[model samples]
Target: MPTNVSNLPPVRRWVPAPVTKEDIDWADLTFVDLAKAKTPEGRAEQVRLARDATHRQGFFYVINHGLDKAIVDRMIDIAALAFDDVSEEEKIRYRARIKETGEYLGYKLPQYWHIANGVKDRIEHYNFPRDVSRREHPNVLRPFLPEVQRIVEFTHRGVLNEVQKLLSLGLELPENTLPDLHPFDETNHSFWRFMLYNPRSQEEEDKTDNVWMKGHADHTSFTAIWSQPVTALQIKDWDGQWRYVRHVENALVVNCGDTTEYLSGGYYKSAVHRVIKPPSDQDGYRRLGLYYFHYMADDVRIAPLLDSPVVQREGVNKFIVGVPPVQETWRKNRASTYGVTQLERAEDGTEYEVVNGVRVTHYN
Candidate 1:
């Protein structure tokens, strides 16, 4: 959930190690062709690629996902209209009050956010829930609601479902294993976001030491971003180096998140990533992005699904079941990031835990 309010507490500045030729070790990320994945002839290779991508980089590109071109185009067109044509007043008319719904839906105007570099990010976003029928308030852009809703539903039913099934196969679990955790029949709390990063003048960019967004891991299972020509997204490498994620035509970039990492018994990683100015050639353009975040129902308790082959061999990590509901974790992460003061952290203390032999954030 996002708001126009500012309340982020002080944190350390983000100064990544300088980029060097040797530090830049990898060439390109693993790309999976969904069309190939669905074919009997290519299924085995597809699964192998999926397994390597998830376990090694925790991020990959998907092509031939079977989304109708018209739907994809419409989604992008509507996003541009929302950001460019719609007035600020119009956006405010539909702004979501998180305090009221206890959920992250609605317009989130740009606000100051201290990143690892200790500079506020210059970005704004509009978040729409996956199920339009469950929306508590009407969107001001009502005229386009039909198309918008269709796109969200299509992404979920078309792309998300297939990716989940493919990953399940790669994990050696039942085809429905991951999908069962996220049933379409339920009121899924997943959301689609339309975001814009305002272009910065050279002087303005020079004045700040921060990147567009501080490096952080998504808290969902996996995040999907529509490929756009503008390139500004970056992902941290296994060796703690930052590298650009090149944009691929008609491909959706997918990255594992915290929940997936936990559910996979730490076999998969929650890739740390951030946005920054595109390479010099693309710097003049304002960056527009579309993202779909997929997650299990809020009430579902998340932990290692103990029966997975990886868990069976290596055992479960620190995140045990029945600690807190998925929604609680979602709320806590959002509240902490946005400076929302209404909710306080539960008295339960934090814990230092190891995953893949490295310490990471964990709470019991």
Candidate 2:
């Protein structure tokens, strides 16, 4: 039977009091302005801030890490055009399919009562995989129009670069986890673009009793989100209080994923989050967002960070670095033993599937 939203955990009645510029945690979550990571001391401070925030709140707001604002605006504009101007027929063409080989692009809707029953998410999105060459999968390059195309490409590249920097700071490995190349290359990692539309009509808003995304953690190592100035985004704080993450101009919200949680051996947390249906007044405008899910190279093994005292306290031992050779063994054993999975869903609603025991998820 389909799950109804009403039966899910009661929408926490407590919404965070509005956040102002003054409330922003500059020391822990704001953007860094330097051309590169700071000196040893600065680097340590940044890492400490990120680690503490992840361990406690599982979410943080980022600024000044060097993403181009023009690019962000262009991407947001293109996303609006794709959803607003493109014909429904054209958008449907990019829908994902689930086959014996694996899941591919197509549109999916939530089944009634699905969330409460542990059914898959009921949302529609466009899936573009970064692992497959654009030539091999031309659909990956398809956008509703030419301008949209340019914006998507640029946004993909820009965000990937930022992701590399984040990974470098979080991981203490000598070699860089993100390879040098065009930001959105499919050869080295997986990248995807997801455009979401939540309902706005009065009928839809009233149906919130049976609708909205359920609580869940992302499966990738980390995710970068550019949310439209809408009201649906919410995060669970350390105190188990639900706080609304209102959209801030030119800011990207970063959160750890399940993979990061496992590799950090619980030193960092994969934040629990969900989407709620907006109130009637705000529903008319569709919610727009672009997410870049970052992954380690195909062979990266997720052992705890050795230098951190937290890992020692958690009993995580040092292990060889690089992707595990037996991907299936690693996935099953990791999830069962450590309680997390590597494969995850992008904002685009595309599932990153393992192929032939290889971790084929995007690393951007």
Measured by TM-score, the strongest candidate is 1
What are the clash counts of all predictions, listed in order?
4, 25
> In model 1, which regions exceed 4 Å deviation?
1-27, 98-102, 116-118, 136-140, 201-204, 207-210, 320-324, 327-364
Estimate the TM-score of every prediction: 0.80, 0.65
Minimum summed lDDT over a 10-residue window in model 2 is located at 8-17
Question: Residue 12 error for model 2, in Å?
Answer: 38
Worst 10 residues of 1 by lDDT: 9-18
- The TM-score of candidate 2 is 0.65
Per-residue lDDT of model 2, residues 180-289, tens digit only: 32234333344455556555344443444433665556656667787456666667667665567767677778777766676666667778776776544564555667
lDDT of 1 by residue, 1-364 (tens): 1121124222222221222233322426898887897678787787788878888888899888776544554566667666666677877877766556555577766654543323455677778777765664334355566566766766676777777787888778987788777766554678888888887656546654436665667778888998776666778877667777876666889999888888888888888887766665555677777898888867776667777886678776745434534645554455344422222233454223332223344221
Q: Model 2, which residues run further than 4 Å from truth?
A: 1-36, 39-41, 99-113, 116-122, 131-187, 200-211, 279-281, 302-310, 317-364
lDDT of each: 0.67, 0.50
